[model samples]
Target: MTATAEAHATRRRTYGAARLLLTLTALAALFATATPAAHAAEPVAQAAYLAARLRADPVYVTDQLPREIPHSTAPAFARLAKRTGVPTYVLVLPGPSGTGKGLLGAVHDRLGRDGLYVLIDASGVSDATAYGVHAPAADAATVALYELPYDAGPLRSFERFVDVVAQGSEKAAQRAASARERYGDEDPAALYLGPSDRDNQSFLTGVLLTAVPALILLLVPYVRRWRRRLPGAKPGRPGAKPGKPGSAKLDSGRKPESGKPESGKPGPGIRHRLGRGLVPAAALAGAAAIALTASLVFDQTRSSAAPPPTAADLTARVHRVTEGLKRDSVYVDPESARVLSAAQLSRLHDRIRAFARSDGGGPVYVLLVPQLTEDESAGQYDVFTATVHRKLGKDGLYVVADPLGGYIEVLNYGLRLDSVGLDLGLPESIGSGDDQAHEADDHALGDRLDALMTYLDKVPRSDEPNTAADYPATPEPVDSHVLRPLFSGDFRPGLLMGALTALFALALTAGVLGIVGKVLRRRNPAPLPTSTLPFTAPTDPSPSYLRRTAHTELSALAEDFRGSAGSGDSGDSGESGDSGESGESGESTHEQPPSGPSGLLPQVRAWDCFDAAMLLVDGDIDALDSPGPGPETLVAVVVLSRAGRAALRGEVNDLCCGVNPLHGPAVSRHHVRVSAEGRRRRLLPVCESCRNTAIVEPATVHTLLMTLPAPAGADGRVPYIETDGPLTAVPNGIPRLIDKVRETAGVQ
Candidate 1:
């Protein structure tokens, strides 16, 4: 099988096992609550009855006596009997009952008392009374001596009656009786005659019991919603200014700012948090107050009252049975004869006999008690079981029934001893037989007995020796019952409320922390600085110097050309002198130019140097050396000028292949050269194929050169250049000169 099928099967098995365990647990609780018949009073009565039987005492005192008779009182009784020459019988019963008189007569008949037989009914403080049997005939005075005193309490009156009888004081008894009569009747409402103390609850107590849990359930959701909204007061939209016609208004009729609260007033978030915090506090306080009030009212209203006469009778019967009192018949129903007809009783007896004769045979007895509550019937059943176990040597099945309560209990004793399978396996095989029998419509005592017999008949008769392994293993306890409420399929208002309350509480806590953090941060602002930039000098000054040198060379070249043109060549010797003078002046200018008036030489020289740098870096030195003016040449100049020579150098340096000035690579080490001729300078490439071409100035190159930075420094000092003669060599001389110019210009 696939994993999913196996998992599903495992889950199904787990659920089935869990369901079976819950059913068993519920059944166990039902049994425990319904059958509380194993009362402590039974054992005490058993010990007392055993003591009485062994001593052969005619005066039988049940264990239900309110207090033990003083040792002096017993001696007084003995002395009175000795002096009067008459035997007395005393019977102390728990409460008044119809059989009290009969019991007293039976004891008197058996003991043959001559003086008197006394029966004390101790049902309640106000109802206690004494009766004397077979006493001497007396006038009102003598009869009064046997009566209780009106002024005295129940215990005191009993003592007074005993004292008067012991002293034989008729006059004193008459006075006491007259005084009791003068005290009048006791209040009936002060007495307690119910089966349980639970009957004393007042109406107010009932109302509070229902109200507290309901209130808690209702408040939980309200609190949770309030807390959930406590984080921030969210506006309808962003950048929605306050006092606008369309904005939402605050409680004060003024529009609230987005993300801000009103001055000197808590925001909606704060108010919500405070309200949420108080909800649980109020609910808990209310619950505690109600609980305290109920407790106080219960304590003040409680009374010390005794159980009813019927409960006392039931208890006495149970004790009697516990003391080995067995009836001659199979059914014992004393309340009414119509409960079970003669034929039904006969049929029940036959069924019991048949069960004894069958496999795993054991005698069965049925005890039908008067109607009692389920709890009361269970107690009686326990006592009956003990009594039957004692008489039948712990080897019989006893069925006790309370027809009025419509309940029945089966007590199995020695079934396991006779046959393990019958004891261990029979109960499960019966399958809710006792419950079904009790719930039957007829609810007849005889019918319940028949049902029990039918259940017993189904018991397996296997006599084969069985080991512990033969039985199915006990199942592990499951927590499925704890989770049973969650799967009940009913709406749980309390659980929902509790969940909402928790969610809101968490939100409130987070919001409060956030607000506190903002306040703390505002109180301690960060420090500011005195200056924005750090003071530092340039690392390299070569480019600055080269720029100045290029300006000086261009200025002197321009100045010499202008001076030669304005003055005209005086002679060939004069022209040679001027040329020689200009060469000397150019060489001197290369070392350092003289400070003079502003001229265009510096600007033109800076532009020429910039153009040359761009061509070399762009790997387009051949175009600069071309004699013809073409579109390619024109495009390069326009691109360089628009982009600027520094920007052009950066762009070409990114695309070039060999090392060159302005940080680019070329196909040759000295791929491009600058040519200076009298008043003009041009760039040329040293390619072997382009050695014969005459260099032409492209308009784009000239325009591009105009955008280069002028060779001027902040200090106005011309850059010093080192050169031996005019720059005439096309390759080695021109490049060295340009390098010197760039170094002096500081064009990094």
Candidate 2:
């Protein structure tokens, strides 16, 4: 054979191989797009396929987005994975914002290990999932990434995550809660969507809404009047009173000899009247319908619901969305469930993808929503699933997982969901035999799906889609209190509440204004219309300043006595040099009494009462800033001085005021009350000034509050007159105590 012949043969073989490849590709494409109507060309969902590689290695990184997340992150991920205590697997891949949980779940299913699975997307969005692991791996991961700086690297976030999980569940949960509050409960928009904000917005919208109908109704009459005013129109109703304004104007121009003008063309006939009535009626009906629709739409999407569906609502809602489910594989009723988290839904997407393949069974459709209640339509589980299956007409597993219900159910129709492996609904299928090891994550939707997917691998397929289904028993209802929703499909409850709030506020404000206006009208009322101004004439000034001369005089005298005691002598000479005592006690009785303490200084050195009073006056300033040289000290000083001088003059002493010893001398008796004591008034010696004060401003009257009575505990410091304690019985007791002390000193 020649060289050209050989080359031609090689070309022919290459062309044949190319033709076969093209033919196979064309056939595959045709079958994929045409054979299964359910597999309509929709958006292709991305999935995480790291289980095989991760089984061999604890850490895996996809270099698909090499520029975004380099392969070098593997070592860092590995280091952090080892620190999680429970066995840990780490994967770094290009996952968009919300796909973290789903990605990890898919990987976890294939790996089939009880460990903490950490998945980090290239953008540093991540989550940690745990299957039968004794660790707070999930919350730790949630909190750690949330706590780190917004632009932190994936490895760095993972490092913080390891630290959080190591701290244990309590701390991890607390931190997770804190992280939840870092931004807010929901989004920042929720800040503006709070109860108060909702009320305000609802009020404004409600007012605007209410006004629109009113305005339309108001315009109906005007619009009809304007249409009547148009040229060649009936000026007034037929067979109307000719005396009416528009009716008479037409009759005045054309009245005949009888002057009736044919009653304005016999009014309108029955058909015309009926037709006229129908227009307005139709308009009113249309207006009412518009308002109703607007109200319903608002009601449907009001209160940005914070709450998930209730038990009954959940079951009924599943029924409501069955028709929707027929059209689309995924029908997340915006009403019945709390918005499923991005990660969890993405995970459900992964399982759906796995089940959807014929290699397993036909394509699977996983319905993810919060089951409002565990006790569903009794006896309806079998019927409901069958009814849904018949409607769908698909040979695949229908897995329904409610995060709130805490259980996953499978309604297999031709999809061998339970035939090939352990049934997810059966507790014993967990293989641990210990029921507690079964994923008891009843409240966590992600957790329930995670457990379900563990037993759900590639389900074996069958041609004549037969049913092999399992229904989980009704779970005990989970307890949750839903607050005012941030955004909900139901608006009436919040609207009614807001309307009530507006009404209450309006009523309160109006009531207050009315009361205040009435009171103000009686007091500073609007004056009668007068020519002159409603002003007062200028008045002369009369202001007085109280000197409190007694306070200063007593304070000065006490200071002088203190100075003399220290400087003059700490001796009895001040008392021994009395002028009349040695001369003649009888002669001394005839002399006039000295009034102030300075005059009695010669005897003060021997008077124990005077000495004690001086000691009290010199005591330290206290915490309460109470005016010291209290009544007890002041009374003792004045009484002792007066008593000493009286003994010199053979006269009776008049002590200072009993209520307030700061007032000079008590020349009269007055009635008063003491602090915290019974309100009963008492007669006591008081100066003219104190008497006036007790009469006019009784509360300002001071008392000799030296000590508390027995009724008051030792710690209680009720210092009121009449209360018993260590101090003398005020001004009256002072003189008696002084005289007793004088006799004890043998000076009498």
Candidate 3:
């Protein structure tokens, strides 16, 4: 193949390879993103297995509850619990359902009769139950078990119940008695239901966040199109038409009509300027306004509809609960600690301390919170492990459990995670809500702790454990709070507002810059050229013949004009010769030529005019010699022919009317021959009356010359004709006329 083809093939192969690589990269990125998401969706069995390992504790709270309870209500409930001598366990479900009994039973089995189980659905439904073992007998009991009235709703009624119980007086007992009397025994099968206002608001906000920006983007293009179609719209580029602004023909640098009003004004009026400038400004302003408004709306919505806490919040809460943990002991809730006897607490503390001593590091900190979502539980485990890893050495284990949610997450910064036979079963084992049915006499919490310590004891230590001095001192805080939800929870609105504000500021800056640039461009317009030469000619000549021909033609034309000026009525000499040579030409009915200086003066001047015209034509032809002639240049040549004819005819008005020198008697031509020749040339009549009158007017000759056309050669030069040859065959007839004038002047 040719070099060009080979190069094209190489480029095509390169492009194909690049495209393939780009496609593969995009697909790989997509797979990389998708794989983690797929992995994060844990299987039901895996969740159950993990749930089974959780250590049940007193006052089990689910992950669904808010991180902090209301101060007004929590203190009252705690007071009520203290007065009743029963621990209060709160179970906050994601939603109300008829199946709440199963969850309640599980909590009841986990904590036993020592605690009061309170089930509060997210929708504000409440159910408070006191087990028979924990409740006082009818004779001794002053306050009967009561449910919040269905009409009052869970949140309000639950708060009221806490207030009534916290009062601890005869009036409070009477109120509880009155509620029991009025509502009677609460239905065991009744389902808790309430409104999820936050969830609904969040859904609506998300929809608007996506749609508003999209609508604004779509409207911008449509608005621009509408503005363009409006009458008297300003063009995008200078010297362009109103509607067809991007037309290619405008680039030719031809002068376009100024957009000034008809009052002979030099520039556009005030109204026109305003109309042109305001439309774009308005479009930009509108987009910015819409974006700003949407951003504000989104911010408000996000703030109002903050999401529930995730794992990070749970982790932070765990840290708060265990802020001042003692060495050689697991950090347990004070209320849960109350449930354990002094001997049991001592034994538990000893076991933990022994484990810490065995590793010569720190005790394995066990945190058993009430309830946390599965995700939050996991996050808590990570946060606790990281905190322990930083505070203690890496050779430590942090186990966090959510007994209310029936799940446990283990974080082993040490070698325990990689311990042999350390599989803790799937999360489903604990989360299946069947643990209560299989409850054994042994305390589930104690058994789980024992199992954990046993596993830790068997875990092989790292062969190259660093000494105490070698360990990092004053380690950096893990900063688990940074992992908190960015566009959710309490900080969502602030984050959204900040981001939108930045975007708006950037857009405003760009818009202002664009407007300023346009104003500056308008203030200082680019200058346009005055002359219209299609192309510039080079000084050097390729072949000597081209330069010689142009010089000779110009020189000969100058000589012809001088000769024609000196001679008087030289046309008769040429006419007499032609007539004598062809006897039939003398018999024609044609006027005799004027024979004097006055008559010849017109022809002399015409020759002089023709000489100057030829010089310009020769120069133009020379400029186009190398590249061949452009279409515009060729058209300009025809226009020059008409101009030359007009100049000649203006000098001699009666030359054609007085005589018809070239006609023969045998022809008796009925039409004036106006030759239009050369490449791509045609012929047309100059004057029909010339034949009838047997007289040729100067106008006829001028007309014939002006309308004549010529073809440029491949090299852009016209063929050089001899001075005395037929003038009509050449473009503009100036070259041939010059030659004829030279011959006539020589004879004189």
Global lDDT scores for all candidate models: 0.36, 0.46, 0.38
Query: What would the per-residue lDDT of candidate 3 be over residues 1-748, giving only the tens digit for each residue?
Result: 6999999999999999999999999999987776344433212222222223223433233332342222123333344445444555554343322123345555455434445555554333246666653432221122323444343333443455455545555667567577567667563222221123333434444434433443344444444544433322332322222322111111111111222244543233444475556546664665466556644644322221113344454444444554635443355443221222334446667777787777533546666544332223333445444554564443555565544433455555444234223334323333222365236321245545555566566655655433222222222232321222223443345445544654675566557655755564353221111121111111121343233323322222222222222122211111122211212222222222234453234443343333323323332323423444333223223222322233333444222211111110112223333333322322322223333332545334323222112344334433222112333333333333444433432311
Off by over 4 Å in 3: 1-123, 126-271, 299-364, 370-379, 385-398, 405-446, 461-748
Error in Å for residue 269 of model 2 = 45
Cα-lDDT of candidate 1: 0.36
Deviating ranges (above 4 Å) for candidate 2: 1-411, 414-433, 439-499, 524-748
The candidate scoring highest on TM-score is: 3
For this target, which candidate reaches the highest lDDT against the unseen true structure? 2
Query: Candidate 1 on 1-748: residue-level lDDT in tens?
Result: 6999999999999999999999999999976754233322223332333234323753443433212221123333344334322355444443322132244434443444444544433331222122343223222222333243332223333344444455454555565566556544532233222212322233334344334544554546543443322222112211111121101111111111122444676654665577556656776776578657756654422222221223343345445444432543365433212245556667887888788887776677666553322122323445445544554554566566654455566655555323444345545313234655546433545555676678678766545422222221221121111222111222244345445554565567558756764564343211111121011111122443323322222222222222222222221111221211112122311122223321223323323333333322221222233333222222223222222222212222111111111111222332222223233543433222122222343222222111122143434222111112112122242334344433433332
What is the TM-score of candidate 1?
0.26
TM-score of each: 0.26, 0.21, 0.32
True-structure lDDT of candidate 2: 0.46
* RMSD per model, one decimal: 33.3, 33.9, 30.0
Residue-wise lDDT of candidate 2 within 1-748, one digit each (tens)?
Answer: 6999999999999999999999999999976656233222111122223566777788876532233344545675788788878898877654432252355665576678888877776445367678878888778877765666543556666788888889999989999898878855443222113345544544545444434444444444444554333221222232111121111101001100111223334322443476467656765675567556645644423222212334443344345557677766665533122324455567777766665553545556666443321123322344445545654666666666543333456666665444434344444432222344244422444545555555566344444545554544343222222223323323445445545554565556557656755674443223221112111200110111011221222232332333222222221112212221312221211122234463233433223333333233332112112343333333344344434323322334445556644333466777777565567776777766667778898865544422322242354444434443223455564555555433322344
Model 1 CA lDDT for position 455: 67
